[model samples]
Target: MSTNKAIFTMKLEPELRDSFMAAAAAADRPASQVVRELMRDYIERQRQADEYREYLSHKVQRARAQRDAGDFATNADVEAQAAARRETLLKQAKEAGV
Candidate 1:
């Protein structure tokens, strides 16, 4: 991919701003490079998230079709199950230091 240079302004708490500058200095890279690297990583994560959403959408559609064909949980039951799954994931993340 072709990289284009751009300038942007940001506001940060003083402590965080100072820390970022210090880290950039220690790493021997410009603050711009650090910000750009972070942005690139964030963009990649966003792209993956969008792809995940698309996959989940398709899975949900298929599940709905199955329900129409006579296989499915009640809405309340499904929601409870999803809530439990979310909690499990959250707990796992916490345990993993995320």
Candidate 2:
């Protein structure tokens, strides 16, 4: 055990606390260790979520910049391009007897 640890407290339902303790006991591990692992995992997931949000915000900004500069395609243009590609593929598939 580390001497630098601090005690933290919070409130939760009695059933949840009992279930968690039971699970830890079943696994032959300390409940405190299980709580520490859960807290660390939760923090890591939150950090990843924050990073993804930052990336998505940057992507949206870039897209807006492109749209503002008139350097982007319209939805109709994209749909027409997709339809043309699909038609080409279908023709090629027929030619190949596929």
Candidate 3:
């Protein structure tokens, strides 16, 4: 029977390694377990960052395409539309007596 465990090796500064060991001991957890958890968290955070960058890239590309196609709104036009909506909402609120 084989255990699902593998050894990972890396080099680190002596001081950092000592500190990590001490902290893990203080927390009453194995240093290897702490390192594994840290690795998992780091991997998850990196994946999320990569996904967000991809999303932002696609959004910028779409915006540029719209602008190139002359399908974008000007700042003034956007402000005017916002103002009209606000005015309509205010009229409705006044009519509702609230």
Per-residue lDDT for 1-98 in model 1, tens only? 66876779988999999999999999999999889899999999999999999999999999989989988778999999999999999999999999
**TM match of model 3 to true structure:** 0.79
lDDT of 1: 0.94
Better of 2 and 3 by TM-score: 3
lDDT of 2 at 73: 89
lDDT of each: 0.94, 0.96, 0.97
Count clashing residue pairs per candidate.
0, 0, 0
Pick by TM-score: which candidate is best? 3
Off by over 4 Å in 1: 1-4, 71-98
TM-score of predicted model 1? Answer: 0.65
> Scored by Cα lDDT, where does model 3 land?
0.97
Clashes of 1: 0
What's the TM-score of each model vs. the native? 0.65, 0.78, 0.79
Model 3 stretches with alpha carbons more than 4 Å out: 1-4, 89-98
Candidate 2: where is the Cα deviation over 4 Å? 1-3, 83-98
Cα lDDT of model 2 by residue, 1-98, tens digit: 77798899989899999998999999999999989999999999999999999999999999999999999988999999999999999999999999
